[model samples]
Target: MIREINFDGIVGPSHNYSGLSLGNLAATRNAGHVSRPRAAALQGIDKMRSNLALGLVQGLFVPQPRPAGEWLSDLGTTIEGADRHIAANAMSASSMWAANAATVSPSPDTADGKCHLTVANLKTMPHRSHEWPATLAQLRLAFAGDAFAVHGPVPPAFGDEGAANHMRLAPSHGEPGVEVFVFGVSGGPFPARQHVEASKAIARLHRLDPGRTIFAAQSEEAIAAGAFHNDVVAVANGPVLFAHEKAFADRDELVAQLSASLPHFELVEVPDAEVPLADAVKSYLFNAQLVTPPDGAMTLVAPTECRDTPSVASWIERHLASNGAIRQVNFVDVRQSMANGGGPACLRLRVQCDPADVDPRFLVDDAKLDRLAKVIGDRWPNEIASDEIQSQSLVGAVVQARAALLDALELSELG
Candidate 1:
């Protein structure tokens, strides 16, 4: 009975929005589009969708606090109000509303049966000190247990260090049993020497994995060329590889190491597209989330542009119908003003579901729980035979066992 799970969404400041009209601001800053007014309107729609999705997922949607000042007054006020409104709606929808806290990027940690979150702080440009402590504190508290393990934002041996925007961690892959492997920057925009030091820190950490980890070094020049931005956006499973064409000069050696040590490893080649790497990555991640299968097969949903561009939709439709188990993948006509992109899974994070308890046929209605129980009983007749086990006795045992597990985990204190 996993009741609570934490997840982080990218939300914060945008310096590029400065001095622009709301429409122009969103177009230039958020969507990177030419139609300023349309983009602004779309931003509103995206925000609403983001809120609804977070609410549905029963997870916290943490955003940076509104910055003070007249210049950002209107935008800041709107975002603040939106956050409160969404949170209220979410609470009303679920009795299991856990907790929501504001912070910049959170530190990474793992604890048995609980997820920890760290929000990215965008207020203090390029500085780690402003929000790291608070982020770390929240993560520590959320994942307080003997099984907790600190994983990311690997600090340098000496001096202050900034956290990387992209890195690998488990749970992100939805693979519970695999060893966590980390990659990405150790420091910030720099003299390259700092990156070397950061790389060294990663190398030391890599040694901890023996043959189980792989580090793909993307050159400073490539990262500067907008590689890091795209990589971060595209990451669905693990760390974004920021590599130039030549960066894989040591590819064979790396592959050999990965094959020897890691349960899985592969170097992915990114396509050269007109869109910014970040945007491309966003689109990739968006699609990935849209069509995740229960059996873990990779599937792609119909493209959003399918209505106007049938050619693109047909390809995905054919693929899904012929190769994948997707029952259907229709292009949903969403309000253009939303802040969230992607369908279904992209918007709603799956918090908890018992494989033994979940009934695929379960419906959402007043009698949903009862229907689910009935379906489970039908599916596993032997496990619930009336002659062998009385219904009341089973219920009592389940309730007692749940209470005992909660007590052992000390979740009562959290309440």
Candidate 2:
């Protein structure tokens, strides 16, 4: 049986707003503010539960160890001896945004008919560059069942940011689909995170049909305005592609190509007049999670920030009233994550496959969620001040808190 499961990363105890992600407006604006790690994790959990209540399958990925020992050592210092900035970046729980987790090819789309996932290299940012090894370890353990095939990321130089740069479109979630890989060149003031070569290599590695795959470059304007990842400017759900007018450098050509391949698909574009590229970035309108359930109209799960933005919220209302596959809009409060440049969609990765093919330890049921909520509430810090990043006491607390979280989920092996 085919299913779409959302694997959300368990927010780490070290969650803080360091503004390390350069192209992220929210991160830059809230650079040194205090963060509520416990609230952040629970907010994510609440979003997961909401999806589950809507009859969606949900799963979890254990957080990677923070203040990564290996990274500190690479810098020729131990965690205790590292500078405050280094320590904060090392312990950043940015991995909680699983959209950058990996690029997945469902069974029906790959040549082998076995689900394939390649962990992202994330070489664009220094703090995130060290995440792949740890992410791969977790992917291996979670998808250990025979039905899955997991691969390590491409070499560091190509600069792959995984699924955030890739989107799948099909008549149905279970069918073989068209994969659109969005890459960008560095011509803007801000760095273009996803490289064209990396996207192509990943498509080849996944063995997707060349005829069904398309490569498109993100617009320089979007990248310069903080659309670092393609997901920040465009999102796809089944056959529907919701995007901004300037999302791609060659929008018309790309749309023509997509229409040729997926004739029946719909393209819902937000023109610059309705919401400028800068406004879109500021509101994260395109960062919303678009999902088509098994038997209902498509739904758009947007962050509360969208509703707060007059232009974005108005545009959404107007768009929904007009005509499109997206019938309903649900706003979720993920302010903590939004402050770090990730919205509702950034917190989870969507995998279309059978649930039984995954490790039960990674799946979520009401019982497991209850336990997770309890553990997060009990252990996660209520406040994490930026200045406290160097405190030995705070570091120790974060370490112990993660240990307790892993133990709660019976995932001590991740430690």
Candidate 3:
């Protein structure tokens, strides 16, 4: 049976989560070079892309829209565009903080085959007494079938209490049982204590064991050596807290520890590189967005730049390849970008996938599986095709289904 999953939207003031809202600052800094609308649009597009990609796989996309009062005036068109795209894809979408909604808490009960929306009031600091009932009502109306839960009124200390950001849930499939890891906050310039507290609260609600969670610690050694970001990324792979390099000797040490302790868990680590923040942001968002179920495997798609970084790509490839549980390794081609920071995994997020769907044997049977393999290859262009045809299962059916769907999406988007 397909288990139901529930997720909360990280509602905040800025489009990007966990980082400073550079929208206004970027505008002032590049006033002559770029327009405010263009800048906002770029960020908005990234946000929309992240949300939609997750929605496509997860079967639900819930976002706290720009605050209720500001929705029509500031974000109505964007919301409408997102709605249209989601509907076009035969997916469900809803806003937690739409104009008529109440305070953004008290998530609703789950409903079958529908998406839920739970809003958070971004205007209030340490928003202690918001009405969760109304929010719950909305969610109940939407996602009634899935397991539903609520997290936070993040404490005042995590960055700006009023800003919005999301917490990611990582689920892994084990042969005998399933394992789950929930990460509440990630990305650069970490948030304050309250944010971490809020994440802890959410993790508890989801039944994640606190003992197993990893916390992000600050280390001057990492910063001095310029390995801070990569260090944090490795720690963020866990469910409880963010990891820092100061806490360990290096990335390998951290990975080794995680491997020893949580042998079933997937460890995602970023490399130390000089890349545009936008691309980095996208990579983080993509990872969070593409979580597989507790019993399934996932493939990380990042740009060629990540591949070139021996410390980053080599480590990731080695981990996935050696790990008995990992199903596949695929690379994304981000060569189109002038800056060239992202790859396949960076651009897409996996919300949901049945373990039954992924077939490693498909890689080995390139010749006989050509037709189906072509469809899978096109959808996932970064994966290296193997010559051996280990399994011919579902090759024909998957190819046909994917081709038809791709054609339809192309026609609809073009129209």
Error of 3 at 267 (Å): 4.9
lDDT of 2 by residue, 1-415 (tens): 8888999988889999888988788899998999999999999999888888777889988788878889898899877788877887798998999989999989889998889899999998888999999899989998887789899998888989888888999988789899999998864678888888888888888889999999999988888888989998999988899999999999999989889999688999999999888888888888888887655778998888888888888898998888667898888888899888998888998898899888888999888999989988888889999888777888888898889888988889989
| Model 1 TM-score relative to the real fold | 0.43
Worst 10 residues of 1 by lDDT: 91-100
Report backbone clashes per prediction. 21, 0, 35
lDDT of 3 by residue, 202-234 (tens): 334444434444333323333232221221122
TM-score of every candidate relative to the true structure? 0.43, 0.98, 0.40
Best by TM-score: 2
The best-first sequence of candidates by lDDT reads: 2, 1, 3
lDDT of 2 at 120: 95
Put down candidate 1 lDDT per residue, 1-415, tens digits, no spaces: 3221223222221111121111111212433221222222223234334333333222222222212212124334422233432211211101011111221111222223323332322222222223333344434544444333333443534221222222332333444322222223412352221233443353343233323334454444333333332122222233222222322224456446544543544333333342333333233322223223333443333225433443334434564666533334444433221222222223222233222222222112224323323322332112222121213453343334333322433433321
TM-score of 3: 0.40
The segments of candidate 3 whose C-alpha lies over 4 angstroms from its true place after superposition are 2-56, 60-142, 155-194, 204-232, 235-297, 303-415
Q: Candidate 3 — worst ten consecutive residues by lDDT sum? A: 87-96
